[model samples]
Target chain A: MRNTIGEVAKKFNLNISTLRYYDKEGLIPNLEKNESGIRIFDEEAVSALIAIECLKKSGMSIKDIKTFIDWCQEGDETLKERLEMFLARREALQSQIKELESTLNYIEYKVEYYTKAVTDGTEKMVKETMSNPRLLNLQ
Target chain B: MRNTIGEVAKKFNLNISTLRYYDKEGLIPNLEKNESGIRIFDEEAVSALIAIECLKKSGMSIKDIKTFIDWCQEGDETLKERLEMFLARREALQSQIKELESTLNYIEYKVEYYTKAVTDGTEKMVKETMSNPRLLNLQ
Candidate 1:
């Protein structure tokens, strides 16, 4: 049995308005309408919704995702294009992950810097430690 | 000898306007001025600029960073508050890194899914493979 848009949205923990927005944006590829003009969500529509959420969380814009959905609807002829899209997105995510890793390192440095300052009763202690010629010569 | 704003900007590969904006925003706690009223950047000023860039990249806002500089300039009395601010920001950066890592996993899954679609000449093939009763039973 198929579910109404409201039921599907509740099951997915998303707002009903979000489902309507997705349908309006053409992101919901297989939105089936009933005799009374209410939207019905089938297994295919549920799958599409899940895929859309996944792609969006991975930083794909809604416009790009719509293009990907269109390519999917076009069948085997668009397989190469779909693959290229994923490749580009994967590469971009890798770059972002690397940048975040560096940012994490900087944050860790701040954590240590502050932890010592807290222990020593003043940040000046940390600064003095860094600048002490005696400590530098010992190192 | 001190460096001009232009020299410092070029040294850090930042736009001259960014350094000016940082000074105007109180991010540079030690912007020295020469007799000609031209901004002069000494070693300490350069260090503060570097620290500002580091904190900004860690996602601190200019206004909040100005607060941090104000605390630093207030000497030992504000050490606890400054330390707490860095600790809070460090915790925030860790959370952001974790979220990005989860997003990276989703992107990796898409990469694999699309790679198979490319290999099989159609995304329908991947869907069929995923739903096969034999595969389901094995899993």
Candidate 2:
């Protein structure tokens, strides 16, 4: 059985318009349309949609996603290329994770600083004595 | 001495237009202007800019950032609010980091699968035997 675009969007927590736009952009390879021109999302289409969402969340641009999808359609001839792409994606995600960790550390420092200030009814003493130099330099 | 907006933008790796827009939106509290109305970024203004970038990176909306900056200008009266805001940001960053880690794992699985496929020069056997249920389920 196949799902309609609306059913798939609801299941995936994605906007109906976004799915339509993705179809319009030809981002979903081999996506089907019924006689009435409504989308018929099969298992393969759903799999492509999931990969699109994952790649997007990993910061791949729409244009790059199109290239990646095209490569997928080319079969094992592009296996090496796909491997290199995933390795690049891995590097990008690692840097992003590191950046978020640093930001989290900064926020944690602020939380501690504010906790003390809220208790003391003033931040003068806390500001004078407490400092996270790495966080301080980041800002 | 104060820095020009251009100098500050280059130092922070931010766009000059973005800085001007932030100033226009009053997102940077106490940002100074010279006799000709050009921005004069003082140490405090630079500090505010850094916080703005950090909060933006943490996924805070510009509207929410403006409110946070306003709270900062309100002195110790907003201490509790600032603490709560940072706590919320901490939670957000933690979740984002976790999501990226999950995506990274999925990509690493794909990398290994593709590497083996490239070595065999065909994915038939490898695709049949090697499966990552989590990655497959994600798609």
On the 0 to 100 scale, the lDDT of residue B67 in model 2 is 96
Q: Which digits, one per residue and each the tens of the lDDT, describe model 1 over residues A6-119? A: 788777788999889989999988789988999988877877877787677667999999999998788889888888888887787777667656665665666677778878
Error of 2 at A46 (Å): 1.2
Badly placed stretches (over 4 Å) of model 2 are A134-139, B135-139
Alpha-carbon deviation at B116 in model 1, angstroms: 1.7
* Native-to-model Cα distance after best TM-score fit, residue B9 in candidate 1, in Å: 3.9
Residue A70 CA displacement from its true place in model 1, Å:
3.6
Candidate that would win on DockQ: 2
lDDT of each: 0.76, 0.87
The TM-scores, chain A only, for the candidates as listed are 0.83, 0.93
Cα error, candidate 2, residue A113 (Å): 1.1
Q: Write the per-residue lDDT of candidate 2 for residues A1-139, one digit (tens) a residue.
A: 4999889988889999999898888789898898989889998888888888889889999889988989988998898888899999999999999989888877888889999999999988999999655445564
Report how far off residue A5 is in candidate 2 (Å): 1.6
